[model samples]
Target: MISYLFGILSIKGKFEYFKMFLVLLSSLPNIDKRIKSIFQTIESVEDIVNIIIGGGAASLEKRASYSLEWLEQNGRCLDHIYSRLSDIPSAGRGAFSRRFIKKGEVVITSPLLAFQKSQLEEFYDKNNKIVPPPDFESRQVILNYCFSHPKSSLALFPLTHAMLINHASVRKGSNRHPNAKIRWATDHTETQKS
Candidate 1:
C-alpha cells in the first residue's frame, strides 16, 4: 500500500495506464510537490517498480523501528496498539491500550500542533479574554484541547490519539490515577538508551 497507489494487477497495458494516472495525479492541486515530481519523472515500469520497492522498504523500516521501540519498552508488540470504546460509564469514548504498556513508556508518538502567540489571538476577544462558547465554540474547542501558558499565547496540542486519553482525577478517594504522561519527543536519532 505504500507505493502501489491502486494495486496494479495486470501489466498488459499498465505502463500507459499508470503513466496517464500519474499525469492526472500530478495535476491535482492538493498533491504533495515531491510526489508530483516523482509522478512527472517516471520513465518506465522499471522506474515504477523501483519507486514502489523503495517506498515499501522505507515503510517496513518505519514499522520495524516502531515494533522495536514497543518490544524494548513493553516486552511485546501489536500492530494496532490501542482500542477505543464507544462509551465508558459517564465518560465518552475512552482510549485504552490494546497491549500491556510498561510504566513511563511512550504510548504513541505524534507531532504537536504548535500555535504561535500572534496566531492564538483569534481565540481571544478584543478585551484579551477567551471568547465565550456557542457563538465562538470552535475557538473555545481549540483552547480546550491545547496546552497554553497563562502569560503566553503559545499552545501545543498533540495531533493524535493521545488526546483521547481521559484526564485522571486529582481529588481524594477517586479511583483514577494519572497513569500516562506526555513529553516532547525531541530525539528521533534512535530509541532512548536503556
Candidate 2:
C-alpha cells in the first residue's frame, strides 16, 4: 500500500486527513536531508542552509496551494497525497531559521566591517610603541572566527518546523481576523499642525 501510494496511483478526494497525509508523505525526503545536514554542519552551516530552505519552503507553499486546488478539481488523489506530505513538514512557516540557530554559537554580522590598517597603526603609536608589531596571527584568528559563524544562523530541523507552524498559524489567523484592532494613537493634532 505504501509503495502504491508512493508510486503510480494518484488518488483524488476532498477528505482533510487524506490531504494532510499526502502532504506529509511528499515532504519526508526533504525533511530527512534537512535533519541530517543540521548535525553535519554543526559549527557554521546554519545561515546559508536556513536561507536556502526558507526560500524553498516559501516557493513550495505557493506552488502547493495552487496544486492542491488543481488536484481537488481533477480527482488526482496522488497529487493530493504529495501535497499533504509536503504541507505537514512545512506547516511551521519560520522553522528553518529558528532551527538553524538553536545551537549556542556566535554569528558574525558583517565580515567586511573591519578596522583600517592606518587606524591600527595609530592606536599602536598612541600606546607608546616604537614600531607596531604585526598582528597577522590575531587578524587570522579573527577571520577564522568570523568564517566559523554567520549572522543568519538557525536551529535544528525538528525545532525549526515547530516554529514555522506556529508562525504560519499566527499569519493565517491575522489574515482571517482582519477586523482585530491594532492599537495606534493617530496624531491628529500633528496632522493639523503640519
Candidate 3:
C-alpha cells in the first residue's frame, strides 16, 4: 500500500498524481470508516473547541443550553483545556495553560451549576465543604470548584476548565499566589444574560 502511494506521488503531472492518489485513497479498505470516525470526533468536540480556541459564543444561553449539557453527558469540558499530572506534592491531574494568559484576562467562560445545598448532601461534609471522593483523595476538590456562601443555601459550580483548576496550597511552601480569578460574565447578549 505504501509503495503504491509512493508510485502515485512519483507521477510526473500534478493533476494525474492527484487523481491517482484519490483513487488509491478510495481503494484502501476501511478508509470510509476512518473518515467517518474523524468527522464524528469533530462533531462531538466542536463546540468547546470553538469556544476555547476560536473564542466562540460565551453567552449564557449557549453555555446553559449546549456547553453545560455536553459537560454533564461527557464528564469533561468541550474546550481544548489540557490536563496532566500535577506538579504539586499530592495532587493528581491539573489543568495547564495552552497559551500565555495575561493577568485579569478571561481565561475561561464556564456555565455554573446552581442548586440548593440540600440537593447535594451526600457529597458535602459537616463543615459544609464537599468531601473528597473515597477514590480520589488528593485530587481537585469538588467544593472548591463551586461557589457557596455562609448565608445562602445555593451553590454555583463552574463547569469548564475552571473545575480543573487546583488551588495552590500555602502549606506546600510554594509561596505562589493565585494568578487567575473568577468574575461574573456580564457582557453576554441581552437575550442570553443571566
Candidate 4:
C-alpha cells in the first residue's frame, strides 16, 4: 500500500500527506462532484498529486492559490497565502506567507461547521442515557486523546477533514510573535464580518 501511494506521489513527504488526504477523501459523499467543482480537468495522476498535496517550494511561496504559472493563469492578489507542513518548533503544521501582509489584512474567510457544547452534550446524553454535560475533565481528556491521535481513532477531526484553519497562534508575551489577530462567531446563518 505504501508503495502504491508512493508511486502516486514521487515525493516521500507528499506520500505521507497523501495518506491523510485519502482519509479526508473517503468521508466526502460526492467525491467525483467535489473534484469536478474544484478543478476544470484532471490531466494525469501527477496533476492530482500536485492539486492535493503541494507547497514544497524552497525560495518563494508558489503563488497559483499557493505559483508563477498559477498567477499567470489566474491574476494577482495583494497577498498570496499558502498552506504547508510547518517547520516550527513544537508544532505540527500551519499557514505561512512568502510576501508582505498588511496590518489589518483579511486572509481567508470560509464557512466552518461547528457543534455547540450544549447540543453535543444533549446528543450524547440521549444516546448513552446519562445526564447531559459530562464532567469537564473527562470531556477534556477525551478531546485531548481525539486531537492527539487523529489518524489513530478520531479520523473525523476537522484537521484531517481539510476543514482546519491553520492559523499561527500568537505566542504569549511576545509582541512580534503574531501581529494579527483572529475573531470568529458561532452563528452559521450569519457570515463572519470584520
Candidate 5:
C-alpha cells in the first residue's frame, strides 16, 4: 500500500519521508498561496511524484521528523484498567477486578472500525425481498467476522474485549444485563456499570 501510494520502485527506509510530504502538502497553512508560490499548479500525479522525489526531499525530511516527534509525544491513548485474569474451568478467559466499581462508572471502551452497513444493505435488502445469492449467507457471516476482527483497525467493533461479558437477557419483564450496561455509537462503544 505504501509503495502504491508513493509510486516508488524501492522505498527502502523512506516511508516516513513520503508520508510527511503528503501531510505537509495537503495541510499547508495557506494552501492556495503556497501552491501558487511553489509550483503555480500541480498538473498530474506524476509531476507531484517527481517533485517529491527531487526538489521537496529536504522539506519532506524536515516535516517528517517534526510529525514523528509530535506523534511520539501524543499519539497513543491506552490503559483503561489494570485487572486480573480469571479462567472458568470449561469456558474462556475473562477479566476480573476485586476493586469496588462505583455506579455509572466506565469499565471499558473501544473504538469501532468502519462498519460494513452499506455492504450488508447491498446483500440483504429485506424491504425489497432481496436476499443474498444462495449460499451467500454463510459468506456474509465470515465477512462480518472479518470486518469486526481484521488484523488492522478496520473492524466493525475493533478490540471489543468487553464483549466477552455475557449480556444474557433476563427471563421476566426485562431482557438486559442487570448490573452492567453497554452503549454504542457510530464509531465507538462504552461499557458502564450501573
Candidate 6:
C-alpha cells in the first residue's frame, strides 16, 4: 500500500511540476520588459503554488473521508489480521498494523485524491446507527502510518485534516484558516446582516 501511494504521488508530482514549467515557458515569449516580466513570473509561480495548495487541500479532505469509510467497512479485516498474528504467540504479533497505521499518518499530512462520495454514502447507510468515533490517539497513529508510508504531502494534507476534523472536532478546532476566518467574518457581518 505504501509503495502504491508513493507511486501515485510521484506520478502526480511530476505531472504538476511539468505543467508549471510549461506555463512558465509560455510566458517567457511575452516578457518584453525584463523587470515587469520578472514580477509576472513571480506572480505566476505564486498563482501556481496557490492552485496546487488549494487543490491539494481539497484532495486530502476527500481522501480522509474515503479512508474513514474504508475503515468502517473493513475494520473486520484489521481485526482479523491482528487476531491471526497474535495467536501465533510471536513477539512480532500485532506490530504490522501498528507500523502500517503509523506510516499512514505521514501520508495524511499531504494532499490526497478525491473521496468517492457514493462509497462514503454506502458505508454510511450500512452503518446507520452512529457508533462512537475512534480514539484520537489511535486514529492519529493509523493516519501517521498511512501518511508516512508513500503519499506526498500535497496529496495527504486535506484528507488528514478531514479525518481529524470529523473524528476529533474538539481537538481539531475549526477548519477555516486565519485568512479565511477574517474574510468570512467580514462578509458575514457586512453582507448578511445588511
On lDDT, the candidate that comes out on top is 1
Superposed on all Cα atoms, the candidates' RMSDs to the truth, in angstroms, are 14.9, 23.9, 19.1, 12.0, 17.2, 21.6
The residue-by-residue lDDT of candidate 1 on 1-194, one tens digit each, is: 11222233242444554454444334433444533444455666655445343331222222223376675864422233443442336443345666777878877765445555354333333244554222233234445556678788676654344445665533335576676777766565454555
Q: In TM-score terms, which candidate is top?
A: 3
Q: Write model 6 residue lDDT over 45-102, tens digit each, in one string.
A: 3343332333322222222233777667532222211111222222111112223343
State in Å the error of residue 135, model 3: 12
Number of clashing pairs per prediction, in order: 0, 30, 0, 4, 0, 37
TM-score for each model: 0.44, 0.16, 0.45, 0.34, 0.30, 0.16
So what's the TM-score on candidate 6? Answer: 0.16
In angstroms, give how far residue 3 of model 5 lies from its true place: 33
- Model 2 misplacement above 4 A: 1-37, 45-162, 167-194
Which clashing pairs does model 5 show? none
How do the residues 100-148 of candidate 5 rate in per-residue lDDT, one tens digit apiece? 5576776565443344433333332223444433234433432433334
Answer with 1 or 4, whichever has the higher lDDT. 1
**C-alpha lDDT (0 to 100) for residue 109 of candidate 6:** 25
Model 2 TM-score, all chains together: 0.16
lDDT of 3 by residue, 1-194 (tens): 11122233345323333333223222323334433232222222233234333322341223434476665663433354455556765454456677776668776666565656554333433344544332231111334456777689766655345655665534436695666776876665553656
Residue pairs clashing in model 1 are none
- Two-way TM-score contest, 3 vs 4, winner: 3
